[model samples]
Target: MSPSQEIELTLTPAQAATGVVIPVTLPSGPQRLRIPPARNGDLVRARVGDTEVLLRIHVSGPPAPAPAGKSGALGCLVALAVAAVVVGLVIANSDDDSTPTASSSPTAASTYTPYTPPTYSPPTYTPPTYDPAPAPPPTTEAAPSPFDTGTCLNGQLPDSTTAQTVRGVKEVSCSADDAHYRVIQRFPGTHDMSRCDANPRTEYGFSYQYTLNGSVINEYVYCLVGIGSYSRA
Candidate 1:
């Protein structure tokens, strides 16, 4: 047989809510009892299991549960019934869809006709011809060169231009000014600059020749492109 007893206890504001299991002294030993939330200074007489308890609840937040115990119990029973009915309906619906038969399978009837999409052809396309924008006009400023006629006429560059490659008597254009060094003039001829034997340390110059050795021989005035050299071609 379960032992029963009557106990008196006071509940703080924190412990007065429903589902709060509070410890109480019993004839057998200390046992925890669950109760609903109550208002401050509320005197409650509720039987928790086989033990009867008189509780004085003090709470600061929400009002206590409805004072009529019989109506509250009736409302709980109605809620449980509604919940059971909803669960039963859900379970029935799930079971009905779990399996299928030949009769339940989708089938086309004699009057049914399959759908046919209309034939479509993309329109013929001819890509347009494209002509890119015209290139920028050629630069007017002439790049500096060895056979600059202006520098040659001005005597800015003379026989002191260095020859990277010497082709006998080939006329070339010049544009850069050799203003840093003095121009050394050479007598027109087809001669290696080494034959001139001019030292660039004291005097800098090279012997250059322009005009092809063909039917008629031709000569040109010399000019300068850089330091320590001349274009006498």
Candidate 2:
């Protein structure tokens, strides 16, 4: 029996009438109790906590009839023998009623691992670098002049004797009514009037000068002729 287990012993009405005397309850732990002599066929009920068991009493020898005159001594011997038998039977039955405790095996302890959040690294911020578009490569091409050789003019030339610079010249188609002069040739980088003498159709020459801060920086010349019914040759 386990150390903490308890038991209860009881007898039926029939067994009690036969004069059985046994402990009604057994508390936890080791204890001792007495069993009164009982008949061979008496039944005792044992309760171990919630379970119940029935135990049968057995005597080794049959009862002898008591002598008619001297019953006390013979009865005493029989009672002693019966008591021993009852005690033995009670012990045997009690042993059968005991429950064997099963040993508990040790269990493996579980290991707990805490969750760790992943390290967060914000993305590095790099501002965009912008360089002003490289200045357009310095233009090597020169600006185009308003008048080109072979073009017709609509206005008269300025009086070369008094004019220092020519202006107000309007180019037109030779077929128009207001067409006045046609340029036969032109000279760049020089304003010499003699350059027009090489062309037979040249009747007038004009010098154009570009000045900055009252000093001539560059010049051009145009050789022209009155467009009197002139047709392209």
Candidate 3:
């Protein structure tokens, strides 16, 4: 094969039933391709362009065993030599006078001290005495109104078209079952109902005007939306 020509080599194992492909390119002169060791029945395939060649692997069996008679005689001679050495050692040890002997006198009993645990005393914990804080003086000022902007109320409007002075409207939680209206926007220092017209969602308008000696002091316009029963008229 030419050096430029490429050969596709495939190896398939008999036990695995799988094929592996390896590319091989031959040199201009003699070249050697090392093939991997395989089982006895494995197959090797080589392809050059369109032509393909398949080869089967053949592995030789193991060598025959040695004769058993010679091995048995050799083992017997080794055992006899070992036995002779053991007998010589036993005779030599029997004549020795330096071996130690056990004493015939009675031994003293070993004394043991009993274990004692250390004494542990629990610490006494004394509760701290604290003087109660004096109760705040009873507040004489009037309670502030709970109704404000963003606060919800559960009440019907006395008049929807004309702005009415808001009073006796206790604020309720927005999630409460009795909540009927929610204050969307509040205009401080002004009681004009037209200010609430900018918000399309405003269904009701209420004003809070406080006067001191015939002069307006504190005023607020609350733009409200009805929850369920009341809607924009």
Q: What local distance difference test score does each model get?
A: 0.39, 0.54, 0.51
Better of 1 and 3 by lDDT: 3
Question: Which sections of candidate 1 miss by over 4 Å?
Answer: 1-6, 17-19, 46-51, 58-233
Candidate 3: residue 156 Cα off by (Å)? 2.3
Q: What order do you get sorting by TM-score, best first?
A: 3, 2, 1
Backbone clashes in model 3, listed as residue pairs = none
- Candidate 2 ranges beyond 4 A from true positions: 1-146, 158-166, 213-217, 229-233
Candidate 2 lDDT trough over 10 residues, lowest sum: 102-111
lDDT of 3 by residue, 78-140 (tens): 545533220100001223324322112112111112347799999999999999999877545
lDDT of 2: 0.54
lDDT of 2 by residue, 1-233 (tens): 33323233444434432333344434433322223335555443333433333445554443545548877888788656644332222222232323222112111111112347699999999999998888766545454464787788876665454535556667788788988788778898897888888988777787777665556667878888877743323
Taking all chains together, the TM-score of candidate 3 against the true structure is 0.34
TM-score of each: 0.20, 0.32, 0.34
Output the lDDT of residue 190, model 3: 81
**How are the candidates ranked when ordered by lDDT, highest leading?**
2, 3, 1
Question: Whole-model lDDT, candidate 3?
Answer: 0.51
